[model samples]
Target: MTDLDDPGLLDDVHPRAVLAELFARQVRADPRAVAVQHAGKELTRGELDDWSDTIAADLQAVGVRPGHLVGLAVERGPVAIVAVLGLIKAGAGYLALDPDLPRRRQRALISAAAPVALIVQDHLDRLPTHHLPTVWADEAGLGDAARPEAPPPDDDGSRVFHVVSTSGTTGSPRAVRIGYGAVLNRLRWMWTDHPFPTGAAVLIHKSYGLVASPWEMLGGLLQGIRSVSLRRDELLDPVLLTDAVLDRRVTHLYLTPQLITGLLDELDGRTSAAPDIALVTSGADTLPVDLVHRFRRRLPGATLLNLYGATETASNTAAFDTARLAEDAVTVPVGRPVAGAELSVRDRHLRPVPIGVRGEVCVAGPPLALGYLGDAPDSAERFVRMPDGSVLHRTGDVGRWSADRQLEIIGRLDNQVKVRGYRVVLEDVEAAIAEAPNVTAAGVHAAPPAGDTVLIACVAGTKDLEIAALRAYLRERLPDYMVPSRVHRVAALPANSAGKLDRTRLADLAADAERPVAARTLTPRGPLQSALATCWEELLGRGPAEAEEDFLDAGGHSVLVVRLIGRLEKATGVDLPLREVLENPTFGGIATALQRRAAR
Candidate 1:
């Protein structure tokens, strides 16, 4: 066996070398550059350093310390940035929670993370059930919570900050421990290969915008570069995003494919403030060539790069730079591995496959993960492996090296499906669905059919495309069994924080649509509350859901509303909108609304 600790190999590059030291070096070298921007406001590097120091001091006040995980659950703004820097300055990892996630989902994440404290925006107050100490992300008092005068460290004390969270899949999120090694190496790679001009203003607009913007910021922050943080919610208006970028003199705009698509749709003739950003990067999901072409045509000044990577894999594993997107290689190639990263195809045995052979792509590099939280070092072998001398990471992604050594991602092994005597790749099926005219994103889910598997496809289509035509088009690419039994043509697919189609929530939506379940009027139960309980029983079906449960969260929607209101009107003899039923959904709220209508 080859020496597992071979010194010559790239895998030997220490993961610890990736983080803290670089951040400290950067800070010391330059402390006066603007570090963050929120809603057009700028915070300089020195200000950010001082601010982060204060925030870190505040975190210590709240009992958070080095090596602890701080839950960063807040909207994308100055507060989120400060909280992140604070946690990292304290030498802790942060679990990012977006404000847009459904409360139940956020609660599940909090449970999984089990953070020492959750730093949140003030508007979000319903998170107590998860029952963790809450640190407000933007506490004005934290400004004075500075670190005390200290003697110099014996060593060059510096730390690379890492943002950690669970995979977008596997339901509830948890803390995925990230050492600076992975984070810094990835940034260093970006700087070496995709260098941007110093002092360029970069606008970060992606969902995990903080994490995604690392490439631009890590490079920019040290060189007096400006980073702009536009609120994702505010940018729901595409014009606002464009305006924000142009107004802020944004020179590098990193956004997800969805946001780019939204901006394209909203923009007709285009006004001023078309961001002067010279380089725009987007990824985390497939960037359709059509969209890529559209972006290229629209943004003539920028170099559009399709970046593909995951949270654990140091944010970006590969990138496909597009000079002209439709140049035969329209599909984004995760590009050549950055410096300190190694890429090779491997078989199931973890042996390296021959060049150009398709197998699971294994990455052996300096930037490998430190492993998940609470997981054993042995557990690292599951993804970070020592199978063939050098430690290699087995990315579930199926890919092969080209003649040029550029990787071509086939799909994920987890996405592979074996139908009745036939193997099917869901990515292949998704590609077929996207073949339908006007379909941008396609999600396919399977349910068990009698003696066979059933396929259901949810596609995002424009109004111009008919479902029948889409169905007909899909029939050409997919076989009969593979053809979807139900094809939903919605405005767009529901994407989670990462801008990739959320398969779990899509599965839930599919189940909800299929089952057609309705909500029942549930009241707080007590012997003394008999009259309210009786009203609930008579007005709707079953027991009361908790106060936190919304009509929609309880799996009730408009179709279910039709049945519910029919039943409610018959029992309570009061008509209410499907909206009213959902708004004041509880038995008490519904009853009170009915009583008001009666009095009127």
Candidate 2:
């Protein structure tokens, strides 16, 4: 038999055959155990099982069937978990839809998935403008129907379990289809190797739509560990989240590098021991050596693990536990493959490169997702066969195998990028920006000259666009990180001899054009304006400021606004509210607000 048919190539996941089956087993073993806690609501395993059973029956009544896809527009809470589990029991795959998304984008995603029905919470204040039939969380008479049982595992493991959307190069949603076997293999591996002490609570920090969400939500459930779902507001404030972790006695936590940095900053060199934390997982960007050292020094009792994976791989394939890592290491290695994963560094022709030589990182084994949702070109290009008849995925990331068999990722081979742990396609950002009103063309680039990498957009529009307005427009359509940090308006973008956009020239322009607009001629007239201008200049990275120059247009964001307000309050001894500062973002306007507050 070929490798595809060879039973030895794949492991048989028994007892806990699939996710729904495993969850059912957990419920049977400890029905009274707390399975999830979110926003003061504690759900026992028995409660969750019964709740999900009712929801599953309701879903089945609404025509949800095996292998069918359903839309989930609920936020992070107990209901979200109930919906996911209930859908699994109904033998349906779910596509998580972000409720905060704009109506247009939501409609587009619904059209793309064509889910049989949308699952939403009854308490949600807003609903997407779509024609799909919806199943409300608070539907009546669901308990009258019998609970559905978990379906048997598909022998070939080709059953789609769920779908997560990643940014596409074509400016549309790229839905990743993960199969039951692929998810089961990863979950089983985590349950076997990454064991948490009994009663440990995994923190669900990311949104339900991100790939990390599954690992946080389902990974804990697989091993009978309780999960704590953070509130949406708590996620935006690191200080609040840190306090929640301490208050909730959270043992397991997951974060991106950016959030880790923010949390570290909040801690501010407090090396006091926090022994309650057993493990801390981080990914989305390369974890710096200094940060790892800092984490070990402070939280010595916990293990800090660096995970490396993609959405197509069903989550992480490799992990490096920094607690045992050497301090003098130059570059933090991505570590060896995790359970059931195989890694190889190969050249363009797919030939294995020698150890210590940098090449494309390829992953083989059960952790691989079935493929992209539909027959997209990238689907075939990513999953290809080897001469040995083994299916390996081309990760497009460059890496090398060390002498000790560790893998160190160097960089990507394409323009696709990771901004603060979120994958983004530069072309996608440009496409979205170009489609904005009054914009003719746009070029976007990730410029990281001195480690402070930020996305810069160079646009050629028919009419001059307000920086704040443009940013607000883009934020509604794209994720925050995909929105350009700086927007440089130009008459026209430069083109090469082939009449195609010359990205190299655009990069040079962005590098040189750090100051987007000329300084306004109106200089600070009084002491208050001068002091406010100085604060603005220092925070915005500008040479000098003008009274008429808008603070937002000068690259000042909400965070910077907070900092500026704090400094002004301390320096001027005036109590100023954030709304006052934001209402008047110009130098003169802020000065006036400060003067009025001082007079009061």
TM-score of each: 0.63, 0.86
Tens digit per residue, CA lDDT, model 2, 568-600: 765767756778877878777888898888777
What TM-score, to 2 decimals, does candidate 2 have?
Answer: 0.86
lDDT of each: 0.59, 0.76
Who wins the TM-score comparison? 2
Model 1, range 1-600, lDDT digits (tens) per residue?
A: 121123332232432322333444556767665677886576766666666677677677788766677777666655665666666566666766666444554565566557787777677765647666777656565436587222122212123244454322222233445555566566656665666675578665544423454564454653446777776434544556666766778787666565677567655446543657688777645566777777777777778887766545666777778763445764566677764677778899877887789898777766556555554343465465473666677767799887777788877777644343223456556766776678877887765433234456777777687766676565443443345656665556778998987888888766655543335444554432344344443433334444443333332333334445545555556666556766766555655666666567
Number of backbone-clashing residue pairs for each candidate, in the order shown? 13, 0
Q: How high a TM-score does candidate 1 get?
A: 0.63
